[model samples]
Target: MTLGALMLVEYLRKDMVAHGKIGLTMALYSTWNRGSSYPRDKVIGLLGIIEPRNSFKPEYSWTVEKVYRVAMRAAIAEDGNLNCLGLISEKKQSRNKNLASWVPDFELHSEPFRDYITSLSKVLNKWSIYKAFMIPGGSPDITTDEDDSVLILKGFCLDSVSVVGTQAPGPDFESVGETDPELWRSSTRDALNQWRSLLPPNDIYLTGETQAMAFWRTVLVDLNQGRLASKKGGRPKRLDKSDLQDLLQLETTDGMEGLLSTWESCLRPIYRQLRLIEQFNRRFFRTESGYMGLGPPDIQPGDAICLLLGGSVAYALRKSAHETWTYVGECYVHGIMDGEAAVKAVEDKSDFTEYRLV
Candidate 1:
């Protein structure tokens, strides 16, 4: 273990190449899962999954507080050019007067929260979720007091894709309670199977080990936080067959293929319901939007799949504009992140769109 200040030791950087980001993060997550008292942010930081600022001192100096300060600046901008790099989630964002889903304070917005995220997005030109998980290495162009809200780095309008998928930081399962254990299990299986069908052929369908590992880490998080309930020591959150319908971009809901539709039904819900739909499951018959990938729950209907210029991974942005196109929270866009499909979309010029992020 190392101090967060010097997130990456020389040997550790080499080890990261061997383990990869998701593997290393999961290893850290596993430690936290084993009852270690570490916040999620701290864990990710020690993995060097944080953006650096100013001098890259040999000594470990980026304390949790300093990191948080950097994070705060990204989250609530006081001015433009809030230089940052990383990804966030739907649950952690509240830049606008967005309503909270499960808990009010958690997913809701405050002045600090709003300003910080706006600046972060403008600086990084990406938004969607979480306490900014900054990628280490880049230095900030501005310096300010620790407590001061940082200025923006040339803000970009995040015109929400007319379509948005599930709201972030999703609802905690334990709080929501399962309808019935048996039904929940069977239904979840059906949902997974439903999602499976949409994947590429069995021979071709496989997520990178990093992403698959990340999915498990997400499961671990959901399990620990009571978002995925268990029966005895824990209560798993449950949903119904009909509730899972939102997973697909059905014509009825105005689903927008890989991205979300500007339609109301898809964006209106706050993820209180697990509303993904099974393909050819009666729901799609009603809509015009053709079946998309083996739609994943996290990337739900009405979200845009964007292959950012510099990013190796594809992001799911909530389309917020038509003219000067904008989006929020570049998140995990399950099927498209792999690049092959995104390239195909661009090639076909059918499902593809070329939009400027900032």
Candidate 2:
């Protein structure tokens, strides 16, 4: 069976019992492939499934942009968090310029990280490991503009993108029935090399991690083949000393050819993880303050990385006009993923700023 079909069946047996809120239902539905020809069906098609209906109604006359905006507003109101923003992707944003930057286009496919972002189990827990926001019981302090196209959020800009690396190779680089690994190896090697060159040689990040260590960790977004390994009867584990030892060889080797010749077997797992991250269509970047991260494919050197109130992860935003920011997409920055930035802000008495996302 297709993966989407299996996910549907699993949702029917498991998720359906737990998910009754509009936000959760919308997040779940975003993972599925809707076959409707009408654009409004993206939201209208799932009205029957969202239980205890608050204000969502079938309005065929509404524009697709309005439908998406209303659905996003209701989802955020019901959930009381900005988790829905995780579903926004550059691919989806590029499809419809009229849609609000804060509102996600449910019609397009998003990244796998959406599952972790929109998870309800992680909502109430403030002290969870690896969470970006540290404020306890924090909820989104949000408002809308006159036309509701602009979403005003309370948060502080953490850092600005100073350097961005090449876009990772897509799945087609290793096409079906292609046995040769040279093309894939060369492309991946070049990308990693470019990312490595962007950092200062022999310098340590603000988090006190070596540049080499942070580079590998950021490339994989600090995850061990979690979701991919679960299907193969293996539990996901965090990156450990042994994993780092194997990955650090990228620095010692002369090039991809030299690396492959000696430690190919030892680095197999690391390579697999890299391929998976590449499939997500991400780019490796660095902030002005020496923070390394994996951001959306469209992330640029001038983009602002912010931590919005009640957000589980960091976001990449671009300045559009005077004091207005456009949502780039979700991001994974090292060091600050577990609330380090938020804690420091409190200690330093840095006031949170209001961001108007359009």
Candidate 3:
């Protein structure tokens, strides 16, 4: 391995130690093969062993081995960023509250415990059902409002497309608890087969891997500590089929071709929006809210601009009837928005739409 690759592998090894063997390295690059150009952010992201502030060091001062050593130490330390322990500690100390209890059973916002579980369940269900999608990557981003209410945002879309059909099937389990061992084995295989068949023939899906699990755990710890009511039985709530329906954006198809076309149309806008959001988050680096990266508006707050790629979307897969994250992976085949070349990308992809920040 090159110095950079060695540094990265060591960094990931440290994270695995810190995060209790959970797969937290999806934030690292999986796109390239052995000798391709490295993605710098992913390497830095994996180096969560170092403080984000101290991640990149002066090239002249530190040798490759020294940097790797330092990163590994950071990953295993008490305050390491590689895992949720520190975050859990912070959650325990915080005085904020959870708003999940206020969410209603009939409403998507109601029954906060069930709500979160339901969303998670759908992801699990998708993983079980879809054979073509790769496992989910990175982590889910969870936040809260000023009112102490929680907002759980999980990012999944076209990114999980590659491993579909290629993954060796995992061992199956029957129900969470099964009395008959033989029946359980058979049921497990049946379940796996059912999952493989339910997915669309050629579409992409999410896998909700280890990093996503860690993210969910942290968010749950935060929620439990916050103002939300604890469950009566002290057990994590389970979401059933009906509850699952409320969280997904499954389309009622008029037909297959139309459905595909509509989904394709809706993708560009969502991709643009997510790119802007990621850029804004990186630039500001805030724990909470602020106007996106464009700076405060001269007329109002910050002058906000929306860059529309490929004109207006031909159609949107999930309509904006409610506040929901619309994920469109694989849209940016060439580049992302964080680099120095971002301006060029915008110019090449679409016209930048300047708008008033509301």
Clashing pairs in 2: none
Model 1 Cα lDDT, one tens digit per residue, 239-315:
33442344232323232222121111221123222122111111110001221222122343555544443333333
TM-score for model 3?
0.20
C-alpha local distance difference test of each model: 0.29, 0.64, 0.23
- Candidate 2 stretches with Cα past 4 Å from truth are 11-14, 19-31, 90-93, 108-129, 173-182, 226-236, 250-279
RMSD of each: 15.0, 5.5, 21.6
Candidate 3 lDDT, tens digit per residue, 159-191? 111111111111121222223434433443343
Question: How many residue pairs clash per model?
Answer: 60, 0, 20
Candidate 2, after superposition: displacement of residue 253 in Å?
A: 4.6
User: Pick by TM-score: which candidate is best?
Assistant: 2
What is the alpha-carbon lDDT for the whole of candidate 1? 0.29
TM-score of each: 0.31, 0.79, 0.20
Cand. 3 Cα-lDDT: 0.23
TM-score of model number 1:
0.31
By how many angstroms RMSD does model 1 differ from the true structure? 15.0
> Number of the top candidate by lDDT?
2
